[model samples]
Target: MSRRSLARFVALAAILSMFGTSAAVMPAQAADQVIKIGIDLPVSGADASDGIPTQNGAALAVDEANAHAPKGIKFAVDALDDAVGGVHNPQQGATNIRSLAADPAVMGVVGPFNSNVAAAEIPVSNESGLPLISPSNTNPTLTKTAKYRTAHPNEITYFRVCATDDVQGKAGAEFAKTLGLKKVYIIDDNETYGLGLANVFEKDFKEMGGAVLGHDHITANQQDFKALLTKVAATKPDAVYYGGTTSTGGGLVRQQMGAAGMDPAKVKYEGGDGISDAEFIKVAGDAANNSYYTVAAPNAAKSASAQAFINAYKAKYHSDIGAYSANGYVAAQVIIAAAEKAIKANGGKAPTRAQVLKNIQNTSGFKSIIGTFGFDKNGDTTSPVIALWTIKNGAQDFVHQINVSTK
Candidate 1:
């Protein structure tokens, strides 16, 4: 064995060792490609019962995706609260979306539950070319009207999985009539969502030959509603339809109706999805009886496809799913499908926000936990459904669902 031969062998061995190390290190580095899904919702204060459950649904999807993610891909959730004090704030939502958009790793977003917050965040997200898939923004103006688009009216970056107010309001009015509610009074919170729903319900009720005794708007944070209830009582209305959320005076109005000479159980109390939450029942207490409401999405808990999701949700959060929880999961699923496509198109690398947005816009035949649906040109769900609910024995009971009619 000559020294020269031994030196040559040593050099070759070192080269092979270094090559082996590089091969092992490359996969670990590639596995670090983290794609984040930003969740902007009112996850604090009174809204937590709704927002936290919705956020939990998205988070649960992320967890499940990571379990089966491709070798070099991983998913994460970046959650931000848009709640200020006790309710959702538009400015906070805009700020949260801007923060999420500036992050290059965030491929898409899944929230801003309230329609009003969505209105404020849409322009910002659209300007940034960031995709936002909402679980619950149901106001018609967010997608039907062009004013909220900022300067990019033609380019849609916001999509929602829920039915719009036009359908929900009409459904509420129809249901009221079904209960023989002939004369009714209407009240709204004066916010974008509440006022819009109230107006639609009013028109539909009138067209259905039901008398609208009077209509009113409640001021923000107005605690004492006895005066308004007294005025409403004077109309001798057979029912009172509130077009606002529990946080925005839905439960309070129903609770105070007795002081205004109307028995909460005898006189029908109706509202939109805003009041179809556990918080509403908590707020209205025993007065919650005889209360009817509607949800913009189908009854996910009843869907066979959603059973696994519901069980997973309960197992993870140790609580029942909220009204929009499955909708949130569906929104995340849409983004996940689009992100997977974008990554493959980019050769297994993280894709650009624009690429992901374009893929989401092209989402078709998406089978979600809720149902089989796709996004229309306006970013609205191709199949829209509304669920009716009632408070019975101090719990939410699902009545039935309506397939929204465009006409």
Candidate 2:
């Protein structure tokens, strides 16, 4: 199915809608080429526990795409590992981007989950004109700020399905206030995502009239946060806010906090999406309770489509999905939509990079497993809903959701 053909079918569907009839958007054509959706992930090492689920989600989308693609529009996924030394590395991520963008078959990419990796790869992808959609990079500046435009000048190829850190940070701060946490200590793993989120949370908490006791930076992937926990315990904060992923010591921090004699009933634990995964509970063990988390996307159980996605994922991979699985799935869906539009618009031919990019930028009310959303001028999601959740009996339980507006 060429992008040019998609237009004719869409117009037909729209006309049918007026007549109170609608049609599913699927077309079959015979072509000799295959379009590849590149997926960059930390498939090996510590973060792989988090990144693998995202990869599995994207892979599921890829499989569905291939099954339904027009004979002329075959789709595939090229998943590359961006992890080195059991963690996310910006240099490795950048190298992966350079390689993926060099491939002619790759129309777009669907990963680089870590914000630090996204920060590293964005410029390289922009230079190569390869549009990249991230499932888990929540750093605000990636799209919500001018950092992309500042680096690329006339180009903007980076996009994300997750809410920005600022949104999650503000919401977490609000949750802290709601829990009567006036004094808090902030800590981050010093990665681009964690450190930036911590900064946003600290600033927002202060603005809400909460007192910030202090801030600390921890080494990524360190198992022993006992020394740091001991220091934080002395501050007598009402709560401790950690702005880092589970792979970057979130579990250790929580466990060590308990070891340091912090009263969870009073000294609550607040964190962003990094600590909101099932893996966190497995790692933190009994120390996972009394923790609250703010995530950019809702839990998969909240939607029928998302549940179907989970079922299909389990049916295929024989494992459960993770926190960012829906994110990766939606990101791939966005790219697939663009590919369809580009092919239909190009007179039944394979879509060009510019065509796909333009279509993605113009996507509106694109309903996926995650939710209905479209990119704004900055390639940020126009309708962003964040969720507040907490661990209950060894599971992440949702509390509430809020629509976060950039304005």
TM-score of each: 0.93, 0.88
Best candidate (score: TM-score): 1
Off by over 4 Å in 2: 1-31, 148-151
| Candidate 1 off by > 4 Å | 1-31, 405-407
Model 1 CA lDDT for position 147: 81
lDDT of each: 0.90, 0.84
Model 2, range 15-95, lDDT digits (tens) per residue?
888766333444444455788899998878667788899999988898998877755678888889998987788999999
